[model samples]
Target: MDSISSRIQEVTPSLTLAVTNQAKAMLARGEEVYGLAGGEPEVDTPDHIKAAAMLAIQEGKTKYTAAGGIPELRSALSEKFAADNNLEYAANQICVTAGAKMACFNAILAVVEEGDEVIIPTPYWVSYPEMVRIAGGKPVLVETKESNGWKMTAEQFEDAMTPATKMVILNSPGNPTGAIYTEQELRDIGEVALSEDIVILSDEIYEKLVYGENKHVSIASLSKDLYDLTITVNGFSKAYSMTGWRLGYTAAPKPLAEAIEKIQNHSVSNATSFCQYGAVAALKGNQGFISDLRDEYDVKRQFVLSRLKAINNIRVVEPKGAFYFFVYTGQLGLKSMNLTDKLLSRYKVAAVPGIAFGYDEGIRLSYCTTLDVLNEGLTRFEQFCREH
Candidate 1:
């Protein structure tokens, strides 16, 4: 009638994007602002992929395609899963969406019902719980300790389950935490999932960003049973620097995949047709660009860790993958938002407050910018901490 629905009302806006945008506004006004709030890579999209898109446009491949995705892209994705992740998926089992986030959203909405419980670990990506809430599901958050490397143990998973539990979301090389669950650890969790018959949404968007000896293993790849129960979500945003292209996909069981496709039919129809050609190139082209990006991010990761270790009064869990350091600011005795505001207003640096990610004692700093920019931001951040 007179106003928006309660569903829309319940959604909290993304504080991460808000802080990044605010920092950009300051820079536009000639202020020297160092922004660490954004979650995108600074690298430009690879030239080969861009060329593919241009070729698609020239060939007039811009018309509407299938609601799921073009067969070519889906076929490439199927091969990607088999070769890289050690998981086999038919082209029909894949649903290409606008982004990995949308793949997750559609998966949650397709299976989760009112009052169903979706288990999410603490200090998770800000979107998971909200997406569950939007689907009329209860988000049951289980806290994972910093001492535990922000990983949920099998015991913790067991304790969180209930008769109403419908799904569990996993972000390996997790956002904010950068924690990748080890193979044995995933097996332990997978054991619980199998025993409980809970569906797993494995978000492996940052799969290519691991550091040191940490290997990214798809939990679904561990066993046939686990594979049957998992919906593996991935995209080109992180690995290929294709965030603006809005391409991501999911490989699920055929039945679940069809349900997601039906939802897509009524929603945004499908991902852009020509952009999908770029995605195909991303999957099939020479992957040397990824190794270069990883080498650069590895350097940044080491620099970030060293800098954080030198700072006093803050404890940062050393991250093994992804581009963030989730620093604990609890000892400062200020709420995370207040701490972020102080950093922004006093030092002209931006980072997402930890409260936005379901933790109150910390903030998240992304190292997706250039090394010089990151160094400058950390300098201001250190000065702010010292002055306060």
Candidate 2:
């Protein structure tokens, strides 16, 4: 048999998936693992959203619609951008795909030719660098150390740019650390990206999930130059608790979006027709449900942040948004993977190793579980830290 492509070999398995699977296998053997490694909300899709999908399917809305998106959904999503985000996207500039991840992949493939460079900030989404490599481009990662709450500075961004830079991937309400970028900070990065002539792929998947006083900002809204150069990749999964629906959309400059649409034409054809209808409901229907969910996440966030702070050997930057807390567990004299193992084996607590998210000596604990269960998981985290 022929060997698979070298590109496939170069891409490492997602560390988060590997750790999650190992913990899952242990649970299958009857171990009581708390499994705080997942990045999703444990909450179910809202009843109204579910009802909408059922209605669509029953109405025989299962056939292929359009490559870009159904007109109704695009129009609704466009209105959503204007209503919620203060951004305008006509139907021509929009294309809906499988999920935000696929939208990101589409953006990368659209812009990244072989050997080109894409600058990714460290403590980034676990998949960004790997996806860049898979698309035959180099991933240029710049560090955002813990002291700065894992944020990229204007100077750091300046140092990472070069003539060959094709794109910069920005993730706010960032995964693992839960660091939400402010509008002023995005304006600074937007300035850098525009000056460098690099395309910006702003991944706003966590836009609606922010907590406390932090607000999610779109980098494209910083200026007209940015609006023309930015590919805004967002989806219904994180915001609407609709991960299983697998619908995401991107609004980009017309010429750039043309390339992404072509790729979508050949690869996946179109997102499920029924799901698109459901997404319309998610976008235009009562959105107070999201706020209700965010309120619960805030309670859990404060609880986990406070509990993790009291531990002696571990240091965690309190997450400002999203549902993650990245804990620096290096002082325990154990690498993060080993620490994860010990935590699972001894305390039956499952947390992803920090190395999974590009930082060694730390671990990511998700607070997306229930109020009672979230507290119990933190107690297990404390037990694991103390015993080590």
Candidate 3:
């Protein structure tokens, strides 16, 4: 008999983590490996944020507070939502988790029941489907066209809906593909969700990283109906370069917030006590760090875009937000896994296989590293394409 529960058996490990681990292993062996597989920014957390955490420790704030989060952090986030996203979420209606990832999982587990369906667009974040499956729900994948900038349309969402459909996940400045949904586009989709009373899990973790004319609009802020049906998830990982801090929060209606809080109560208990203070500092302290980070990412994005355009047999859409490029590598005559394997093994550049994001024709490359690393990595990548 199988020792593991069937639920645990059904989940697939994260391919992105696997690739990154292999790259780290190569580097440990004193090998020169260009790592572009990581999802977080390659920067240190702001000094003020670190100071806040240290101060908390100095003040003896190590004990566990409420499972959701400290009142100060939640209240600060409440103000942040009002000021940044134009959404009103009372402190009681927010639940802070270990990371934005936990916030998403708690939200999923709070609403998704056995045999329920959750709609996720293609080229989704690697963890979405796994999270849904972990909650005993079915993940309905809708294939989005690269021509449409890898965004799911209202019509496509409506067509995929069934009686079992309970939620739809939207990641603006999406991972793998940095597709930002416009306000009008969100309104169209919101209308359908409202009619069906379907919940919307809006992941805006990369909201502050957006560039050019693209704006990050929270679907929950579009209208009252959409607001009632949405769960907004954000964190300090990407924006504040605090990935190791493991701070993220979810703002939903009171009932959903309470349910997610209950889940947190039984699991990790709460986000690190001192880290909550750091997150509070992130929200209330200097806002200039965000704009500076966005500017740097934008510069790197443009540099990578130009280099990829100069190479043959690969096509990439210029990302409007976020630091990733979902490069089409189908013309190289290999699926994403094999392509990435050869790229890593032969060319010594590490990148994530597109199949991990449900797009086998492409691979995902992050420009979060230094420009020198990106330059050398892209050079080797160009050679790989030429030989193929």
Q: Quick one: best TM-score, which candidate?
A: 3
| Candidate 1 ranges with C-alpha deviation above 4 Å | none
Candidates 2 and 3 compared: the better one by TM-score is 3
lDDT against the true structure, per candidate, is 0.93, 0.87, 0.94
Q: What is the lDDT of residue 114 in candidate 3?
A: 98
Cα RMSD for candidates in order: 1.0, 1.3, 0.7
Model 1, position 110, has a per-residue lDDT of 87
| Ordered list by lDDT, greatest first | 3, 1, 2
lDDT of 1: 0.93
Q: After aligning candidate 1 to the native by TM-score, how far in Å is the CA of 2 from where it should be? A: 5.9
Which residue runs does candidate 3 get wrong by more than 4 Å?
A: none
Give a tens-digit lDDT track for model 2, residues 1-388.
2588888788888888887888889889987778798877788988888888899999999899889989999899888888878888888789999999899999999999899999998888889998999999999989898898888887898899888899998888888888888888888888888897889999888888887777888888778899988999999887788888899999988998899999999999999998898988887789898999899888888888788889988888878888898888889899888888888778888889877778788888888887776777788888767877
Clashing pairs in 2: none
In Å, residue 209's CA in model 1 sits off its true spot by 0.3
- For residue 124, what is the lDDT in candidate 2? 81
- Per-residue lDDT of 125 in model 1: 96
